[model samples]
Target: MEGIDAQRLEVKKERAPKLPVHIAKEVTKGRLLKHVEISEKSVLPTALDMYREKVDENLKGEIKTHDTSKLRHAEVVEKNVLPTSVDIAREKVPTLIVNFDTEKLKHVDPVVKIALPSVNDVVREQEEFKAGANEKGGMIHN
Candidate 1:
């Protein structure tokens, strides 16, 4: 310690442990600096701005009151429009007389008796017509 000069005293720095020769050889080489470029202007980190909108509301109302009063009125009128004389009219009508000869009318029959064909009779007549038409060789639509 006495042989060492004061100005020649050396200071030592702490270092991590050394890696094995095989691991050191396996490490890949990299570039010292990246290829990206930066501008002169810089941005600061700040909170975003909050915006608020204002709304206007309006209210209106109306009130009404009424007063009523009664009023009285009177009016009179006079006129001379009567006639001096008046005439009456009378009419005569003759009476009507009818004589009924029911005795002669009872002997004459106004309504004659008529017989209508029943369903069976009508069907039989249609069948006969069809047979006659077929014998006459005339074409009849169904």
Candidate 2:
């Protein structure tokens, strides 16, 4: 490994990752870490002086991705790809397959005429007309 001088590293004050303003001004002097902590292990910082500019580009890319996702979500709503009011109404209220309009609904004809027996017919049909009241007040017919 080649030895790198820390004194030669340059500070980029304009485009550092968003940090609290109350931090020490000296802390801002050396933007690149001498040894960065990553995955529980300390690693050497990059010699690149333009780190802040690269980070700004990354942030811009993320912003563009977020905006694109929002546009795709809007497209799903604007197009009929997602279920709409009409689709929901049609699903809820189904159309009747049997049409009553312009077509006669055949009425079920009821039994209008039934043969009823008269008093003469009932008396003539009876072979034995003997009827008397029994001891229990119920009539017995023969």
Candidate 3:
């Protein structure tokens, strides 16, 4: 094209897709931007956060790590907190026993509507399902 002017000769550069113009913003949209200092620092994505999120989401309560807190200036008790079964068996050292008065309860035998089978039956079942009764292998063949 010989008649084309200098202005026409210059190719128009396409605007870099205009970042796909986001119209609808979230409720917490500009709130995060207020906290971030764009000039001073480069803010990372929300996926890379400080808090370690629990992936498993345990239904049961949190597992206790430290049983007892290490007190700096707290009064330490010299006495044993918990007693062993042997200590419980012996009545020599009298301990604090909080017992509820069951005087209101009638001294009547509780009738079992559904009685569970005895431990003996469970043991018999275990014996039947023994891994190596015949000394064959860890697992029973039949």
- Please tell me which predicted candidate would have the highest TM-score against the true structure: 1
Tens-digit lDDT track of model 3 for 1-142: 6556644545322422333334324322665444555576778646534333343334223444433556367788798679878877686444423354567678888787987889999888878768446465566655
> C-alpha displacement of 93 in model 3, angstroms?
73
TM-score list, all predictions:
0.22, 0.18, 0.18
RMSD of 3: 27.5
Q: Indicate the residue-level lDDT of 10 in model 3.
A: 51
Residue-level lDDT for 65 in candidate 2: 77
Least well predicted 10-residue stretch by lDDT in candidate 1: 53-62
lDDT (Cα, tens digit) per residue for candidate 2, span 67-87: 554464334445557888988
TM-score of 3: 0.18
